[model samples]
Target: MNALRCLGLGLLALALPVHAEQLPRWEVGMGVGGVSMPDYRGSDETRNYLLPFPYVAYRLEWLKADRNGVRATLFDSDKAELNLSLGATPPVRSKNNVAREGMPDIKPMIEFGPSLDFNLWRNEADNTRLDLRLPLRAAIEARSNPRSAGWVFSPKLNIDFVGLGMPAGSKEGWNLGLVAGPMFADRRQNAYFYTVDEEYARADRPAYQARSGYAGMQFLTSLSRKFGKTWVGAYARYDNLHGAVFENSPLVKRSSYITYGFGVTWSFLQSSELVDVGDN
Candidate 1:
């Protein structure tokens, strides 16, 4: 649910990204788009959701907000930096998914914490770089109010190539990014997605307790380019749950799944001067 719900925005943010050449101090706008994605993490079902995307990202002296997630760069150097990671997940309704039929609906989950990033490799003249990122976030859910769920630690290796040559062998306009990593969650987070209680359990699904363990692995790639007032971004993601600790859960439907999306952002308003980076 967390991965699928945010995939759209994540992709769009890439599409509407701010490039180095057009480093506008700030940007503000909105757009309407759509994304087709699976119902949840382990479900085989699919649904299309229309998205009302709000555009907001501030590049400032101390903070930077973009598709990469909001952060206050407390420490920044050529190689390593530390900041906060803000992320969230959408809820899954039991009635909407077959495998979760009789179970209670899930509440929205939010994560916030810190991250340490290191520049594993950088070739600025070639416009390429590799980064290793480690982020630890506390998970929470808001049903009646915010309640702690558990925690997640995701470490990823990210590679980027900007304004570089493409498959056609031209460097006119293209930006590419690739990232992969494993996700780990505590027992509470696992229970939130895999546990089954006696009251709502069906004949096929018995009451069971879940334990803390590995969640899954994810790989994502994105490609983008800008054309005048419009920008296009395309992305694909894969999640492997075959080796996941909760694979035995009755509510778990598929062992693997793919989520992809395409989006476009139009820029009608922009600034050239160094404007104050507003709150995003």
Candidate 2:
């Protein structure tokens, strides 16, 4: 059932045109890469979960610019821009050790959330600048073999520095960023497979009815260069979670870990006409 939901969403994402106008204003992008989550505490030893993450986003510019819209655009300057964005992170897989004696099998997990972006500064002359973004997300995740599911709310802050200085036609450059935040999840999501009481709750791990919260922080940085109209970039991030519930949860015994990877990014749309030169 969970697999079907994931497949349906994946297909839906694919069915949509690479560049479609579902909303009044939007930009579309698709990326492929290798991702690894290593050093989660619950496991007997370090385990690396390799998977791919694909996503899409839609923005309503006119509405955002208006005070009556769901989100309002606060700042628009030649060197800076700020906007609110609602987005989602589809289901992805995670590898886990089942037998305790052998390697782990791949499992599935899903997440989605909303975010705000602030362009701190942009230098047309230098092409070097910085940007800040904050993403607040609420996610529901489930596992394949154990048949366990949970809900989590996370608020993450990211800072980016772009080294855009290069030859006029050069497509190569680098970007570095940092990510830090907190994640809170209910106990039902943290319960063990066998300990769940099915009679009380429809899902597993019903016995653990306590609300568990944790503060987790991660650092991410990336570097990339453009090829023709496409840009290739790679990034790495590390996470550390600390709190009573996180420390005691069986699912995440090791609260500190590192996730790092390399990927390619492509910008499908670029328009100088849409770019605003002054505050409206």
Report the lDDT tens digits of candidate 1 across residue range 65-134.
7544565767647567786766667677879888788777878777778988777876535456787889
lDDT of 1 at 161: 75
Give candidate 2's TM-score.
0.53
Candidate 1 wrong stretches, greater than 4 Å: 5-9, 13-22, 166-172, 274-280
TM-scores for every candidate against the unseen true structure = 0.87, 0.53
lDDT winner: 1
lDDT of 2 by residue, 115-227 (tens): 46545554453344344555444334344444434554545554444444655322234444455556555555444211223343333223333355554555555555447
RMSD of 1: 3.8
Question: lDDT for each of the candidates?
Answer: 0.71, 0.39
Residue 1, candidate 1: C-alpha displacement in angstroms: 4.6
